[model samples]
Target: MTPAPAGLTCRLCGRADLRSVLDLGAAPPCQRFMTADQLDEPEPGLPLHLRLCADCLLLQIPPLLSPADNFTDYAYYSSFSSSWVAHARRFVERAARELLPADAFVVEVAANDGYLLQHVAARGIRCLGIEPSENCSDAARRRGVPVHTAFLDKATAERVRAEHGPADLVIANNVWAHVPDVVGFTRALATLVAEHGRISIEVHHALSLVRDAQFDTIYHEHFQYWTVLAAERALAVAGLRLVDVELLPTHGGSIRLWAVPAASDVPVSGAVARVRQLERTAGLDTPAGYQGLAPAVGQIRDGLLRLLLDARAAGQRVVGYGAAGKGQTLLNYAGVRPDLLAWIADKNPYKHGRYAPGTRIPVVDVDRIEQERPDLILVLPWNLREEITGQLSGVGRWGGRLVFAQPRLTVIDPGAAAIEGAA
Candidate 1:
């Protein structure tokens, strides 16, 4: 057998003892939105093979793109989802009460557009955002959230600690998965954290990803899909203890973990044990646990393709709702192109007038949906189906329907209408 790709070591455990679990073939970088002038040239793609580490039981992908290549001028803005913004506010409200006091120092990693840190700063908390994306960091600074535009590794963490002292609270929400050197990132978290400080890391639960068949979330940007057991092993190596864990509904299904210095006297909460046991019971720590997603991924891809082809054959026009990163993965993997998907409508002005990376589908403002009034609107971010459905509910007035293609393709109807799918 041919050897696995070089540098295929586990991001968390530093183990080269890896097994190939699934392959979605080659795909372009998820956030590389293209302009019209660049479309005619050949687009590049990288191998997107998922590997499982037997030592740590972590499911991860080798980093194909560097941090500068992916995040310097990022197109994704966190505030696009109203529900996500609300989730951030609620997290701030709880963190302020439970984690830190007013006037205490707080630092958020990958804090984009100040969505969460704005709430932290609003409460008289001295907060700084460590973000690498200049476009997003500038927006956060404009929102009065002080931001340091650099990736958070050991050196940057030491620099921040020197400037601001040890942080009482460090937020690594949803960014751990993006870090190529997750061990380095966790060590940085340990470096910035005060002796008694708390670090909260939010990650989409890998168990949930397998259970719900959310394979579309498997993109190049997300280097790892975390399970609680895997996270515990990683954090322990950094001299941090997983003290608490909370399951969240945001981003399909996620978990918020609270860690503290290993020497700290805080008793590990029961929530940690509960989630760890739940993961073990689900067989996440073994190779058998990682075996289910390949078949489901194929079914979802085929289902979505059939739906689009049938719609086109029936003379029904189809346009996508959001040009999200996950949507790009789904489209590119399922072999969707501009011929099948007319255009994608997005709220972000930066993404508007751009093209999706591999498919080259035109991304326009939502007004295109209003002007063209396609017969079917394929909502790309299926996790936000309810919110997107309500926002586009007015489409019913024109006999148009909204459809989602995760966990299977299903047409949504608000008025007790029957859910439709491919035959």
Candidate 2:
């Protein structure tokens, strides 16, 4: 792959001096994980630099890596995890009760494998999904969920409006923050949704990411880290206004925002006002918030690298758990290679036969842990550390320990399960 650019202008506000909060050194491009036969030649490493808009307090990395580079046929599948399936089902059920009626149309963006939209369809409501990943779109189609394999923008919005009329409910989860054109993307939603339509967007809360030190979520694909304040500004610029909001435990503390056209009757709830107040208290939407993250992020990097180096020096075999996107970000930023981690294990079959995004570490079955019997196991998807620790309970039969790096690096014996509020 070719390099994208030296840096990018702010997608939300078009400003530069995008202060660098943390720099994860170059590693193999994440999501370029290939088969053994394709491994003779390697892909190029893009700069994994994290920046903040001092003016907007938006956390983002330059699109040093473009959307097309990362979103190929085999991007991601949502049906693999039963836990996530339940999460989607609950979301649809709640949406049906609180937001949508039986006769209205509901559209989902990046509706991989129709995992969430299936619930909406089952409620006898009209539904459509716009997914860019061909593999995931095919899977969704197989499940009888109509999916369009195309990137959504203003033009597509007009086309959809001409064909199916404006949507009554638009649901985009975790997709809004990945686009470089925040204004245009939200404008598309504004165009595609009717005046009476309701739009709900879910994205990682940038404020929580900084306060909790979830630095791993910073990557090439995630274009912007959105806070309620930042999103409100972008949406308002696109002719929409936020009405209601909720903080979800999903994806390491995400914000679910309900919005409508600026002229609509959707009442702006206290939740929106409360979230703005929270942003002010956290110093978000300003340059000071961006400046404050630098020092704390440095400490996290130093701590994790020191632990890995010390374990290597002591002749301990180390392995990684979870081939998660966030894990890839942390590995590339820390400059960790296959030399430090023997291999990685994951439950997602889509990645089981592939290597990691940047490290080129092969992903094997969960038994690799028991077979290799590594002295130390680093859990990359530390958010799921509890579930993983529960499943891998036998790791301690040979005295193995599991370590997680998040707010800080902590090592827990398998017998210990997990620390409170981890991940």
Candidate 3:
């Protein structure tokens, strides 16, 4: 109930009425995967707390770190997840068929490794990517997707607009929540779109975070957790109106927002009102809606720790499946160390030899799962359980079971039905 400290204002509304929702203590930057040489050195931790703005209803955290610190040399590549790439392909195809003109100029912000823009280019459409990470942008260029390696801000938006004219369609997927300046980022998004063009944004819905106790998704890299209400307010700051919203199953749960210039007179889709009502019904329009998350987060932490301890006592070998950001947050917050989880397996070769940021668990290739055949495979990125479960389905041959910690610990047999209390 104490007032937010001076200068701690809402990133979207500039309001000082920021109320604490949940605090996961302090955690190291989730993406700061350390090499074996650097593991001996001290790794710094920052405050990982979630707050809600009473004025704008924006669910956010203090900007403890800058985008440059987190994204300059990013570790995540969108191409690693086959399902995610397929989702991007479908989105691009739908946009081209239903929204874009014959000669539309498409621009995507934070286009990691040209996952989506490659699909645009395959359709013979002129597309460009704005990526901050030099390595990621290099990969994009290799895919024949044009890229501008810079963060999107007002000045950068103006320069891009001046160079290429306003984009016929601008896509900012999964990057909206990572930005600290919500209003400014929305303005940049507006500046990039043509007068009558559409801007598409995809953000993990905060409703799912609270309802499902997805506290693992709260890391320093992600500055905010968005809702349709907060998104509409941010969009209005840039003279853009939310014309449509589509709920997606990706990233646990997400909302794809479609916005257009306010003066464009585009008819608002009924989905907008429907999603708005859902948020309202869930009490996301007010500060009180976030009150239940702190306790839910505690349950997740205790449940995961207990599960790990039980497995270890039973002489079970447990290893993590993904070296994802969410996994880093969950493991670090729950105080899980290498003793509980031997090593994590990831498909991204960039992380194969590195160690998880805070937990310091060695990251190995997916082949390690077959080599070690651990008794339990703790799937960290629970949102991608289906995809990961399919990939690790062969684990059933070795009597290895899969474990999902969030939303409660559920142990499942990869080739059989989920055994709720099997763990």
Q: In terms of lDDT, which candidate is strongest?
A: 3
Alpha-carbon TM-score of each model against the true structure: 0.97, 0.91, 0.98
| lDDT by candidate, in order shown | 0.88, 0.79, 0.91
On a 0 to 100 scale, what is the lDDT of residue 361 in model 3?
97
What 10-residue stretch in candidate 1 is worst by lDDT?
1-10
Per residue, candidate 1 scores C-alpha lDDT tens digits across 12-131 of 767777887778899889888888899888877898888888888888888888888889999999999998999899988987777786569999999989999999878888999999
lDDT of 3 by residue, 1-423 (tens): 345667798888888999889888888999899998998899998988788888888888999899999999999999999999999999998999899999899999999999999999989999899999999999999999999999999999999999999999999999999998878888999999999899999989998998898898899989999999888888998999999999999999999999999999899999988988888888788787778888888887887888899989999999999999999999998999999999999999999899998889999999999998999999988998889889999999989999998667899999885667732
What residue pairs clash in candidate 2, if any at all? 24-333, 30-357, 31-357
Superposing every Cα of model 2 onto the true structure, what RMSD results? 3.5
**lDDT measured at residue 243 in model 2 versus the true structure, 0 to 100:** 91
1-423: candidate 2 lDDT, tens digit per residue: 112245566778877656777666665655667787777776777776777766666677776665666665755677766667898899888878877766888888878889998887777788889888888888888887888787788888888888888898898988987787778889998888988898889898987787887878877778888889888889899989999889887777889999999999867898888888888898776756655565777777778788888889999999998787888888877778888887898877777788876577899888788778999889888876657788777888888888888766788777756543222
Instruction: Give me the overall lDDT of model 1.
Output: 0.88
Q: Rank the candidates by lDDT, best first.
A: 3, 1, 2
**Distance from true location, Cα of 86 in model 2, Å:** 1.9
Candidate 2 segments exceeding 4 Å error: 1-8, 416-423
Separately for all candidates shown, the number of backbone clashes (residues 3 or more apart, or on different chains) is 0, 3, 0
